[model samples]
Target: MALLWSRISSILPPNEEQFPLQFSDKVESSVVEMLKRSRRQLYCDTTSTSRMLNAQIVVDISWERLNTGTWRDVDKEWRRVYAYGCLFKVAALCRENPSEDEVLQAVRTCDMGLLMGAAIMDNILQVLVRILQSELRKTAKDEDESEHVEIKRAKIVSPHVPSIKEDLAIPRMKCPSLESFNTNHLIPLKPVILEGIVDHWPALNKHPWSIDYLRSVAGCRTVPVEVGSRYTDVDWSQTLLTVNQFIDRYILNKDQTSQDGGKPLGYLAQHQLFDQVPELKEDIRIPDYCCLCEGDEDDITVNAWFGPAGTVSPLHQDPQQNFLAQVVGSKYIRLYSPEDTDKLYPHQSQLLHNTSQVEVENPDVERFPEFAKAPYLECVLQPGDVLFIPVKHWHYVRSLEVSFSVSFWWS
Candidate 1:
């Protein structure tokens, strides 16, 4: 054993013992200035910040919860309390002291500060989701525990818009046909899909750098993930597929293989894509954010798909906030935590860093008992809808029908 250990050590190349996560003084100063500017904007356009916060959700996590019960009297307080603690502390720095005009101008001019604000709001979105889901589970559990409790039928709700085809007419839209939702759309849908600062752009004809149709047109190496397979959730031996038939025959069954309930769908693993696309580069603007670190070429090999009435994308967090825009079909998103490591059931080793450990629908508390402790927020995105995924939050996606989403990092 000693000889083997020595040989292994010898074969390993000497490298930096540790890479510190240090921010340069300039970056730190820039963050502080941006925070200040954000506060000014908050004072001027109180609702603008509010609306952005409503656009999405974020989470601040740590590996503290492992048992079924509370920890040091704080766990009983709920996860929201912990995440907000992080958000307010960060936001407060920007609001130290502000004059009315300066605050307004700062709000108007502070784009970078909005990133912090967006993150803060993202935390709120997470907390709300956790609490609401917790309450639902509590109520359900309580009802189950009770004897002879009354059960009522769920209420049906109607929509304000006549149909998907109808336009949202407003005084701002004298010509309803040309009316655009702009940013205000995310507000009404706040408790749903979008939970952070909402931004919109005219839909592009295709992904900025994705090669979506290649698999359909070419032959590529592929790995088969069969139903009931274990630890097969994220295998990425495929370089490309011959066509949709190849996926249907080989990949669809992999859904049942999971450490928790079942593995959710994932794009081609980063390693598989990166090895083939060395020309791929890190995103120049947000280099630190990409999950694959493939720069602009990530979409070339990272794209994934799902069939109708199926589940994919088990709850997991990544390094980047994905700009997940749907082009073909609709799907549902349920998100989890960055720090709630125990509940999500992270992979046992180093590769865990690259994948979320959480399972998809049909969560089984018996095996992954701690999963019941994790809180989640959900949204259903349709064609042309976009979702911004902050780093390290667990998310599960269920396809309503044949679905195609183009996911890319925004630097």
Candidate 2:
């Protein structure tokens, strides 16, 4: 396909204005025939052939192909490419679930983001989303009572408030050894910044983990990205996009506004991204500090945090001790001792009990007056800094720039 596209590009007019409309009718017809053959070969059940024949098409795109076209034209082609990318991803998903029934089931649960992102066609995207949603609803109605109970639990919500002072700061240290770290901080449940701990990590080098490098290697891997003011916000939601799309829309084009007028923060938070893309794991190292554990190496949970500046993690506590290794950009981290539990009011909602209700940056002090007195230790973690956060220590984190951090959690 690359070779064919290259040949086509060479014959095309160099001036963008003279180039033809982007729609390739031949390619579209060929794609349809391919889908038909795939359905026939995979599901030989004659009774279901008609439904497969009429399967709803999610992508039918037309736009200007040349660079001289308006921004709208460029955006149109972008969506077309994204839609094709998603179709390939859907095939991958189906391959993962080889059985015919399971493949169809997986497609029913696929979200709108996989079908389209920044596509400028919200009306069409809405129609596709509703189709999937309707299928999921029907599936739920057909499920047993146990499944219904589980679904209901996910919908339930309860609210609570937390308290934490905005002005306090967390403590910092420089490269404390394993022995000194355990004696001075770990055993005491103290939150301390350990600088120079990640200086040797490959991610700190100039080339491999750069934006261009990451896009080249892991670009096609689709991962869930958070889009919102913060995870705790009522409007928060998750969307799927390729790493290349993420870098293009959120990282490279940081200043441009989305269809929604607001500049929503895009966060790839707390995902075991290294597990999903092992190549990325090569860029990071498991700090020796995690070796303090008596169990096997698997006891440690490694999560990647990548996002643009302005992404916020509401005050929350984790179950295991954490070493948050900063690789790129900076983050403002604020920590409160576990002893201030009552002062730092936790949410009453079961799902968010570990999360605080207070927005640390701009607290509603009048409503949660005790928040004004709750002491918090704060620090801006720079590249190569690893912040040790003891279990159950209330911490509020916000990205100070386009940032990427690897967090190691162990019992």
Candidate 3:
């Protein structure tokens, strides 16, 4: 055992020591300034910063100059260096903060997990958090005042958007037959509400998924959550938090102000949550209509949409046919056919081509005059309702209450 330990120690790099090394004033100051600047850049325009955070940093290296397989080795070595580099940046940002709570928040930034997942899994994240906490306490004691003023606690304002009484021109039926729904809606790329479709699902009554029930079942489980009201917002970001932490901070901690000066809205959107929490899958049954798809019913993709009120999925279209089952609360859904693609003004970026650039509720007529001519279908999906949205049908969804929805996508 002693010989094995000695060999392992000899092979490791000096920087990979068992304990962290102390940095000189010059080194620490430079790293601190760089980290602060990086933080400002990161939040300045989150969409661009997200790309910067996750984009691979490539180093120019000629394979011709190295021996066979040596280039591969060099690539792997640099990749590992890149990962550590990200962790160091995160740690520096955390350490420079005078508030312990702010330090924790910095570590919880949505892209941080993507940037430093390997470090977190290796317990390096815990070490960094502890170091940051220690440094923050020391700084607080040394300085007579905090670096910035903290907001006083207040009541959490409701972020819910009240539903408008608009004419819903779409068809709404009570548990329509699979054949009729497929022929009348699916084949024609139309949207329809099939009420009572999910009435038998345990989630509706037999096994209700209330806040207390969710906390009791999967409280400590870590899941990725959206931190802003809508993805289209400039400040929108993602973060990994436990079910309990999400409920406490976003659901229970209403006094907290969001970056947009509104209540922070956390949403667990478009995630294969049933796969993560298998127990929850048993609560809801797959709609029989899913069998109509060309592929096997089991092959259908299932996702969970759980979030507080006001959470929105900006006007977007999915590539596959979707069965959105509303189990708890209600959501306002608006749809437009693919034929209106030109009028809707889809985003120029290929990545977001499926999404619309217009804000449906409040469109800038001068900027998007054509948008007014596009005919749209609307509906309020209540509990026990399953909405059939045909493939490539542009749709916008917004939660009206503390909501839980399950979506199934298939060809």
lDDT of 3 by residue, 1-411 (tens): 112223222322333333332333433354434434433443333443342343222111111212235444434333333334454445333332224554444334313333323333254544443343344434443312321111112122333545545575568888888789878888887788888878888788787877756754455455788888888778889887777678767755545754356665888875546654556888988898888889896789989988866778889998999999998778888899999999988999987888999998889899999999998888877778888898999999988777789999999
Q: Pick the candidate with the highest lDDT.
A: 3
Model 1 segments more than 4 A misplaced: 1-231, 234-240, 244-311, 353-358
Q: What overall lDDT goes with each candidate model? A: 0.37, 0.62, 0.63
The per-prediction CA RMSD against the true structure, in angstroms, equals 25.3, 18.6, 13.3
Model 1 clash tally? 23
Candidate 2 segments exceeding 4 Å error? 1-169, 206-208, 254-261
User: Model 1: per-residue lDDT, tens digit, 1-411?
Assistant: 112223222322233232111223432353333333433433344544442342112212211321235554434222332233333332322233323332222222222122112223333322322222222233332223221121111011121221221131111112112112223322122112332211222222323222233231211223222232223354523323322333433333332442244444333322222222222222112212233333464343333343323546556566654656564556767665576767777667785555555455677668788887776666666665556555555667666544556565432
Q: Kindly list the per-residue Cα lDDT of model 2 for residues 133-186, writing each as its tens digit.
A: 333333432435663453234223221222324455566778888899999998
Candidate 3 colliding pairs = 110-238, 156-254
lDDT of prediction 1: 0.37
**TM-score ranking, best first:** 3, 2, 1
- Model 3 lDDT on a 0 to 1 scale: 0.63
Clashes of 2: 6
Q: Against the hidden reference, what TM-scores do the models get?
A: 0.36, 0.61, 0.62
